[model samples]
Target: MSTRLDDAYQWANSADGPVLVAVEERQDHELAAGSHRHARGQLFGSMRGLLSVGVEEGVWLVPSSHAVWLPPHEAHAGRSHGPFHGWSVYVAEPACADLPRRPCTIRASGLLREAVLRACNWPIDASTAPLAPLAASRGHLAEVVLDEIRTSPPEPLGLPLPSDPRLQRIAKALIDDPADERDLEQWAHWGAVSARTLSRRFVSETGFNFSAWRQRARMMRSLEMLAAGAAVSAVALDLGYSTASAFIQVFRRTFGQTPAAYRVRL
Candidate 1:
């Protein structure tokens, strides 16, 4: 783990602090953190590059403009698509009562970003009386940060996973190769389940039907590829889109911007 991540874990495990912020800048190599859980909820975001966070439920792609929220004690892991610059805010379990209860991708508003950057300068320890006023100010700032997080709208950056072993096998396969180009009947046969059952279960377990879920998988993968400097046309073809136009349309609908524009921002 990087120093910032280690500090985040320490702050998260400490009951003495209600909230703490950790900032990191890494340009040498991509980041890959192993699965772990802490006693505190985390709001993690990047100002540059893309990050993917995974939990038992699914994976969420965190673009530079968005953040992922992990409720307290949620087992999760994270990997950056490329060089990353980000911040993490750890909120004590007791202080997370009003936060979102599930893992999700949220808009990282300007106000929230500024508040976190400011809070980074506050003292990490809460026990010192001489810094009591600073600590109080930090507490109020934390409240603003939390409120911004609570009010920010969620982004459709997550690909939810199914619980059934059979469905899970299929989900993994699709994530491994989003360009598989298999129909429902084909996938159902591979999973050894009837097409009707596969279709129904996908909706019941993932809230998305087979086709929709596959498209979402492709979209998420495209985000990572694009962030890594893949050409827009190449990404479209790699993800099984018949034409660049089709991919561009989907990308625009999902993110309100074309892949090329997103890459420029990165």
Candidate 2:
């Protein structure tokens, strides 16, 4: 664990070209919220396991084959949904100035991944010959990643954070147990706030009404479960839907496709 933490720190500290540090392994932990507002842009690649990245607007999941590219000084936190392993790429700020200002996950094409690996290990030298090809390749790979993110479907999995501490606790509880049937009144009682206040506070912090937020959360959780190959009936049951058909109805409505079809497509 210490060695891996050291590696993470080193990867963050080393800034030359676009550095790619693959997560060789990881154990489960609640990656606390904070920002590493570096001079360079950061791309978090999670080829295995699930991760969550919180930006100013919302929290996004970084699933396998997906990565989040955070523009410099965007104020964000890196979270792991479970155990995670992948690369962390630190792109030169000048090179990444044009990247997306918000959180996004990019496709990891085979060639692009290799280019990132090469760029990460590039050595600083006086000779400008061998470095030219590496620089060109890194630029190409960054372009590919950006293009993929732009074209990829805007997944229905973002659950925005609640800024208020009380509301934040409620949101965290929902994430902990999506099956919880606690109503606004119950949440208010738990939070020691009035129902009206709870409702208003929830909307004020998350930018979505309670039902809307939960629906989005359910959709995101369902997506994660589907990606893990969970059976539709089981997923529905686990998410507290009365029936699989009911869950499928909501899933299709939100995603514009049936869960089975979506899973097959994925």
Candidate 3:
């Protein structure tokens, strides 16, 4: 973990409550909090950046339009891909019964976002009652927030990272520069493994061959770049796609929206 994120993690350290909220307004904020567990489940909402959240299953790329729900005691770590502005809502056991049991990213609906943002300002200590009018209302917005999470749509935008050291290094290199068009044989040479060995390892570790993994990496990166306001053609070339049209085809297929459409929605 980077020293900067280590510092950012400080904001996340709080007393677990039936509902606890922490807001981070800095665009460059990030945290790796490490492969640690929290007694309460958490909802991570990113307002303006891409977040790379890692758990036991894999790493998920969360764009600005999304949020991730992590069940209780599930070891996880997170880092920002760019400028990120977000907050977290931690809910203790029974209160989190309605949320997803496994790690998954959900679309942050406007209502859910408002509920979370509102909760951030009020005291979330369930032991004590809130005094604010908005918070003191009879509707009990906290439950509303969790209900919104339960119904929100899930997005299939995560690119799983290989756990094995050799494959992990290769995955990182490719993610760092998706434009690199190195073949499996060339990457095998860099890893000091036979091409056959590397190919076998790639499938076993991530369930995706080299080419497929690279494609997924490129597609995920394109979402981040697009969220940052990059032009279609520029993002395409940056991610090693030959042309804007080709990139558009893949992007449309992967995300079900054109780059322009996606940005407009964001």
Candidate 4:
């Protein structure tokens, strides 16, 4: 990690400081922030490039207009797909009582984005005393940012993983090769489990049926490829979609926009 990032991480884990602190970052190369947890809740997003964040339960893909929320002490790691321009907001644990308890992807509203950017301008060591004028102003802005996060709808951008070792193997394979054409029965056989057992285990462990999980895996892969500058049609074919239109339809339904539109935003 760079000195700046190390400092940010240390600040986030500190118990006493600003109630809310925002950091804006721009990196020229892909970067990975390894697994770690902090004492403060966090909201992380990228305004340019794609981000893949992994928590205990699953992995979430955060696109340009979306952000991931991690409650205090949630172990997680992240990787940027390309050059990244983003911001991260860390909130004191006490102030995060009413926030979402689980990691999730939230649709970042314009107001929320601007609020975070504005907060990023304040000095990290700024006074946090309750009666200080600067502190008061910062408090109000923090409340606005928190309210925006609490009210924003979460996006369906997470791909939950199964806990069972058998299911884990299957999920890993699918993730490794989203173009795999294996059916449920075939996967069960390959995993050395009965078809019925595999089906039931998938739903119970991952909260998604085998087919749905595979679809989500493909969608996540598509997002990575798209963000890396692959052609829409090429991405479609590589992910096993029969045609570009079919992939576009699925992408639009899942992300509320076409792949090309998403790439343009990047």
Candidate 5:
């Protein structure tokens, strides 16, 4: 349940500068389910699993292709859909606001990934290093990557936080049981709301249709299993698909990658 600077912070703080840390084989439940912010801007990325970071209002999921940027002192807590190894880049405050303010999933281009790896070993005092020019070059590269991040389109599926208790209850239940066979009409009738009313409210609140939301939910669950190193056939069966081929088709349509490919990248 460590809730302080990540690896970078330890090194930086130890040397009175900056340190980048990479930790593997950790459980999110160990940290509890809450938000905590630090002075260092945080970059949370995992190569082999899904990570969820929640703020007061909404929760953002980091799929394989993306990472989350947390500005300095902006309270947030992270959870994984499955087992994961995380890398954190503890950048200084001056670099914080250059990242996104709200929660977003930014794609990790090859250049961006290399920048992160380089930053991990950044000298505690690069400002005065003999390779000062190299440090400056890395800074410029980071800035360029951040700019591209800002311009890139956010992930296609985002789980919007719902305000209404009625909707929240429904959302939670669905997450708990993705195989729940009830249609929106059945749910609306049970909730004493007409199907049309429920559909409109869902769109207004979550920006996804009832069916679309359910599909995303199912896909998200599958992603977790894949990240956990589950076999494709087993994951598909767990998600209620008739066969692995059906699951693969849906996954390809939604994420543009097969489960195996995504898992391999992770």
Candidate 6:
């Protein structure tokens, strides 16, 4: 963790109240708050940029329209790849027991989005804000956020990295270039394993077969480019899809929206 980035951490760890942090990031700015845990749970989201959160299982690709929920004391590391408008709510375990116990990506609805922003505006530590003097007001706002989080639906935007070094070799190759159109047989060379062995290891370590994981990697990477204002056709071609329409079909099936519609919200 960077020394200068302790403002949020300090606020979150201060006393028993909840915390709200708003980040204004630069395109070149990289925030790598290494793997750490807190007594409280956190809800992380962004209005811009990409969030890569790594837990014991794998990494999650958080887009502008999505949020990630971390249960209390769950070990995780987060990094922002580009300049992003990030916001989060940190509440003690008691305030979030109603939410999911697992670390998962959530599809942020309009109500959940506003509730987080509202919490930001009413930081519990700020003395000058209208509700700054009242601790009850802060607790109430956090409760609202908790309710919304429990109601928010989950999304399949996570990219699960395998634990084995052999699988990591293949995973890294695809992450470096999602357009790599190689099948398991072709990728086996990178991992120094037979094609069948690689396939079995992928399932054992990542809970996904080779083909399914490759598509997930491509889709997760597409979110960053698409959110950064890339055209649908360009993103499709960049991700190795034969055509924009074909890419749109997969994207629509996964997110229930086409690239154009999804980017408009960003």
Error of 4 at 249 (Å): 3.4
TM-score, cand. 2: 0.75
Better of 1 and 2 by lDDT: 1
Q: Show the colliding residue pairs in model 6.
A: none
Q: Predict model 4's lDDT versus the native.
A: 0.81
lDDT of 3 at 208: 84
lDDT of 3 by residue, 1-266 (tens): 33334322332343433354444455544444467877667788677655778887776556666788888778889877555567787665656676788888877776788888776665333333332223345237877777877787766647777777787778778877889998998998997878898888788877888888889888877876876788999999999888999999988887788999988875
**What TM-score does candidate 6 get on C-alpha atoms?**
0.74
Please tell me which predicted candidate would have the highest TM-score against the true structure: 3
TM-score (all chains, Cα) for each model: 0.64, 0.75, 0.77, 0.65, 0.62, 0.74
Candidate order (lDDT)? 4, 1, 6, 3, 2, 5
Compare candidates 2 and 5 on lDDT and give the better one. 2
For model 5, residues 56-92, the per-residue Cα lDDT tens digits are: 5565545555667666677788665555555666555
Model 2 misplaced regions, further than 4 Å: 1-8, 11-14, 17-19, 45-52, 58-66, 81-87, 94-98, 106-157
Write down the lDDT that model 2 would get.
0.64
lDDT per model vs. reference: 0.76, 0.64, 0.71, 0.81, 0.63, 0.72
lDDT of 1 by residue, 53-75 (tens): 77876655555667888888899
Position 166, candidate 6: lDDT: 83
Clashing pairs in 2: 23-86
lDDT of 6 by residue, 88-204 (tens): 777666656577888888867667777677766653332234213336775676666777778867666476677677877778777778899877888897678898889898898
